[model samples]
Target: MSRRQRLMTLTRMLPSLLRILRRFRPYLRPQAPLLAGALLALLLSTAARLLEPWPLKLVIDRVVVATPSGGVSGIALIDALDPTTLLTLAAIALVGVIAVRGIASYFSTVGFALAGHRVLTEVRNDLYRHLQGLSLSFHDRAKTGELTLRIIGDIGMLKEVTVTAILPLLASSLVLVGMIAVMLWLNWQLALAALLPLPLLWLTTLHFGRRIQAVSREQRRREGAMAAKAAESMAAIRDIQALSLEKGFAESFCCEGNRDLREGVKAKRLAANLERTVDVLIGVASALVLWLGARLVLTGALTPGDLIVFLAYLKTAFRPVRELAKYTARLAKASAAGERVVDLLDEESDVQDRPDARPAPAFAGAVRFEQVTFAHTPGKPVLDRIDLALKPGERVAIVGPSGAGKSTLLSLLLRLHDPTEGRVLLDGVDIRTYRLASLRAQMSVVLSDSLLFAASIRDNIGYGAAGSDTGAEPGADEAAIIRAARLANAHDFIEALPNGYDTLVGERGVTLSSGQRQRIAIARAALRPSPILILDEPTTGLDRHNAQAVIQALEKLAQGRTVLMVTHDLDLAARADRILYLEAGRIREEGCHAELLAREGAYTALVRGRSGPPSPALSPAITRPIGADYAFGP
Candidate 1:
């Protein structure tokens, strides 16, 4: 690589590396004491390594040169001492230096390993918490498998690199600096020559490191994509088998795996080439230094022992350079992994609570929307200028076609997404002013596809306890659970199961029938003491017999709560105290079934288009004129 190109690459990488380190400050600060001890041990070890060669140099120069009468000795002190005694001291000093180096090296490795593992563990945990706090919009756009790899796989790579590459590089750099200082003290001219190969090593590292990092990043992304594909296929295994798509999915997954393999091989090849180039440069530097040192020895500018010591320091000094080349690829991969972790940590949640928000008080269940406008994408409003109100203990059923914003209206009320304009109010106060958890605790929901965790049936029901606001632990008592189950008409089937309430429902309750799962979900919602209830197509995907049972249970559950139900069943809509007919993101009609039908407006056309006339459950009220009777009032 050209010097300018190497400099530019280094310039780009240094800031990112520094940013990654800055992000780790909080995690690193806690382990400062361990790191400090490690630094001390490293210094002691470096000092020992620097002292190690001196004893041999002294023996070869002083004791070997001394005659029986200490003839021709340069130092008077050495001349006064016997050569035999001096040689013995030198051997003892060498053993002591080696012993200290070994002991210090052990402590330093343990300390750095302990610190690195602990820091990475903290990073992993904090990353998970941040992911959970992110808004649903983010999760909607993100893949589960990629996020999973960042939490587990990327952080693991960082830990491995820290242990295998980072600590050793740190120790070797210290040794390199110490060796250079000694070399300069011995002879400054030779010291300059020893360092000539370093600039070449730097350029080589810059060229290869960037390529390795890029490949590693691509490999990680491919791995995450493969994981996502596998997770997607497994989650839809039933459909995959029914459609016979297993072979197709396997082929796609293999394709991604092969791409990752190619990247891995390419990274290793670059690393190997860089290491071999570094070896050649070091050999050249050594040959030049040996020739110069031998000339100095012969010209009486240096002794034979001095020349030997210089060559020894030269090899030791360059060893760190060789080590850096060998580990450059690993370090680059780790750098890429660390950047991924840092990016995740830096992601700010879109819907976190405001700092000034307060816990919500007990709700009386009055809800209103004031000119609320929302769109998942701008300029395409889903619920446009919706101005509506619901009284305490009233039941409102929203009926609309697909994509008519029926679900979006309910989502706005629940604060799943903030309105682009205006506000959603609960009991006359803006709901955004309330803490998210507390506000959500004031209502209970049963979705169309009721999801059950892989746990005992009792535990799944107990998730509703958060809405109860009882300040008690999760998981209701047996009596309460049975009561809620009975209210939802789920107790009989649950009792029929071998494990009763303790039965493991399996993931998403896949083992249970649609009706059974719906009933359990209803039981969970019923267990909550919240005064506001939201139901979305509760009878969807169920047989008529099961739907009737569910409707009966729902009637009992909605006895005194303010209920908002979104459904397409006109039979059910006709029975509501109030009905809203939404279309094209606006409420086209709003009144009781009889009032809207009497007008022969949009609501009337909708009723006429159903498979048949409204059911007899509507009673005498269906014949009333628009103003003849009250739909709902206390």
Candidate 2:
């Protein structure tokens, strides 16, 4: 069992280590000089340590037991020196060697640590940038906590291997070779006895290496699961409390937390068990060498001092061997972490701009969808064979049942996902030909569940204003933000707050009411210099007063820009120049509101539901042709 496993140590650590090498290759190449310098320092430190043990051997033989006639000569000068004087010189030399070793080790570790930090930071930054650039579809399926673990926990473990384990492993390997060579020259029989337990030690390390790695990987995964559960519970704490679901959520969280704890305990037990076993094997090897060396000393094949040096060298030689086992264990786990980080970095994003895509010229707001079809999954169409054209500045309202693909229109318009078939064009050119940033710059959107960052109201508004300016950073256009807020009727409330626009809106705008958050979002959209506007249930959160005010403002804002609104309110839909009734993923009917109502189709049914008796309003007298400034009374 031991022999077969003896050579498996490298096999266990190799896979994860290889991944680390490949992922960090670009970052490491530029730091080769620093790495090389660290290696040199490690070598110097090892030399000093090896010399340290020899000084004692010299004192024991040439000075402490030097019978005036001299047992044997160490150096020409030391042979002539008196015992007391030689002992003093040897002690001083030992101190100097120790000092040199300390300095070298310090410099080597510091260099490696700095380099490791640099690489870790770069990896973190690159991972974050890539994650941000990934398509929404990817984020929809990937867990937030898993990605966070890769960024925070996994990379942190990798740094320990890179900075702490690497240099010691290199230096210890060299020292191991040099010490064994010296020990053999001193007494080949003692050297052989010293290495007798090496195979067993190697087998022990190999046996436990995989167990530790497997346990640690399981531990990290459980931790991620726990983190995700906690985040989810915290995010919905309000609902949980309101619905009296705290107990159930707490129980669920505890279940996951216990799972993570068990994983951690398993890993600790494996590591502790390996450590104890290695220590016992090491003791056995030392005992064997001691017994043999004593017999050889008594046989006059080796002197007492020679025996002492042999023992010292034996301990020194095996020191690295013992430490090597520990390092291999750590490296195994670090490799698992590296694998996770590499997996995330290597993940391909589904959305990417083509090399030949050019910056879109300013849009004229003329939008068209020609035979467009899209599906999140094959054969499960979200939009199918849609054909429509909206003249520049047309006000179009889209009404549909819950899954009739109303929201999907906004996604396609923003190029969040390309069509499964056909084309969407702006001004007769395919939108895919435009650079993403340029194309998005020409559109503004307001969704009911729009996200807000933990920032001041002014910064949130400026974030949108900045989008209108191609070269400016977000939150750089304060004046434009204020202007947009006034237009959205948000400026009065903003000023009424204690800190005005500078007040920090807590996480996800939780500090404000839903109505206030909605207004702020509307202001954000109003700040964009876009030729097209897309709103989904835009007035859902507003009170009647705010809704009416915003609707009035939107009516004015709608002029000279194509507006597409998705709403359940048929009254709002009736105000559009045209109403598009969508069902199942295809347009069923589209015409001026009065015209569609008169046809008694899907639009008529929706209007009838909201208007309750139809009130003779579907008659031709009410079928006036839609014109600019057209609106249905609130």
Candidate 3:
């Protein structure tokens, strides 16, 4: 893009950036008293700097120029001063001014930093909350490391702009303006000479600002890529080690890191060049001012004191121009960082609660699927034309081959993703008509890959029962937690841990075995005791021993609750009262174990492991006793 186009883009994005900053206005408000103090300090500091030159002018004009004699001895001149008294007063005034300036500057800096920190804290919190609310699809496609860098690294860049760049820019501008006004009052011609470098400085900044912004953006993008690579590699470190791909991954990371470093160095080089150019221009201007002021003094049109004062003001005025030129790079970096932060905040989730939706009333687990159909993508249905009902406390098992839509069926029941063509109803009410939180709260779900947070075992088990008094008193009751653990067959293992129930699980519970994590998840779900329960491959990744233990726990959990389990194990499916066979997104057949076998179709072939005529051993009567008393005996 052309330089002008780049600048235009930055200008266009400013309004949005400002709007984001406005969200932090409340944080800024509380610092008003500090801001006021800072402003006062800044004003005092500027006043003190302006006053320093006046004393020199006073000494030159009053003492030196007013000597009546053609020449006076140095001793006579010292005596003429009333010596100690005059010097003492001047020293006292100068010291007082310096003291005020120092104090003001200190307070101002503290105030600004506090405000910036407060704003950044809020921004980080909001970003994290928004990230949590985003749909799973977004996270599936997003890079973990890149998102982490944006939240930490990019946001840190913004803090530099707020605490350092912003205040310096403000204080310097004020000082520059004040100095220029004083110089103009002293001598307009000389002031014009001193001001000659400013236009060039401005031109230089305008020329390089867009370039710096481009380089900074490129650098940030590369950094994010590097972070993403590192994060991916770290997450799969075990796989990388097993495959011996560490060298390859390291080389890839180095390539990205080198790119970021190169872009960063390029920006720094350009900024340095710009600063050097400004310095040269200011030097030339200062020389010209001095030469002109000397000629004016020689012609008796100005005094030595006036020339000295003009030079002092000239230095002050050029200081901000020089500083601003240097800060252009920092400002560019901050703008890019702010843009990323704003992008995250601007994202709108696909799933949001309806405006007039009400919290769903407590349910008694009557779930119905009315011709529901869904697809992750167009023209590829995952669940199709399904109509089914669960009469309050029915125990149903879904059986199918891999990718047979069994898991999708259970997911739809929980409303993880809504049906595209039809509605799911609970107790005769459409699920979407109710608040999502309340709707989801009515069902308990357990997935094969159970995730655990870095918290005590007790906390993990009671995660779902937040804010409830399960046993007695508020908070998660220790007794109730233990009961739930015992029911899930997790009590024994948990008690064996170093801290028992209070033991902190490492990240994702990596310290525990897969079966242990699954049991804890089951215990969590059991604690919820929702009206409806859906288990998706809940017994997967477990050996025979653990599977049996889990199954026993599940039997207790399913007692009076409506249960729908999706599994591939025919043995587990046989335990359910009824089994539904799904094929190609539709329910092909559903019956008791013997009924499906009597048909001598898919289920029979699958069980016998052959395509020939069904064996007598696979006879329907043998597989299932039709008239036998099968209810659980007390």
lDDT: which candidate is best?
Answer: 1
lDDT of 2 at 386: 92
Sum up the clashes in candidate 1.
Answer: 0
Clashes of 2: 0
Expressed as tens digits, the lDDT of each residue in 1-634 for candidate 3 is 5558756766865785697677567667777786777778778777777787765664565455643331232446444665345456556766787787778777777777776787787788889988877765577778999899988988898887888788877777888888888888877888888888777777677677768878988888888899899999987887999999999999999988888889989999999988899889988998998899999887876777778888888887787778777887888888888888888878776655678889888789888899999888888999899998888888788876778888878777766677878889999988888877777776777787789889989998888576222332222577778888998999999999999998999877888988899889888887775888888887777776777677777777777888888876566666677778888899888887778889887776666645334323223534564223222111
Candidate 2 structure quality by residue, lDDT tens digits, 1-634 = 4554545656656766776788799998777899788878888988887787777877776766653333566467767777788788888999999999999999888888888889888999999998987887898888887788778888888887777776677667777888888788877878888888887776777777777777777777787787777777788888989999999988988898888788777767777788788888878877887788778766767766676777777677776656756675577667777888888889886767888999899889999999999888999999999998998988888987879999888788888888889999999999999988889888988887677899889888877866664655656777877888888778899999999989999998998877778778878888888999888877665565666666765765666789888977565677888889888999999998779978988777766554333322223323543222224322
**Which residue pairs in model 1 clash with each other?**
none
lDDT of 1 by residue, 42-158 (tens): 999999998888777777767765323224346767556666887888899899999999999999999999999999999999999899878777888888888988888889999
State how far residue 82 of model 3 sits from its true place (Å).
6.9
Best-first order by TM-score: 2, 1, 3
Two-way TM-score contest, 1 vs 2, winner: 2
Listed per model in order, the count of residue pairs whose N, CA or C atoms clash below 3 Å is 0, 0, 0
All models, RMSD in angstroms: 4.3, 3.9, 5.2
Q: Which candidate, 2 or 3, would have the higher TM-score against the true structure? A: 2
Q: Residue pairs in steric clash, candidate 2?
A: none
TM-score of 3: 0.86
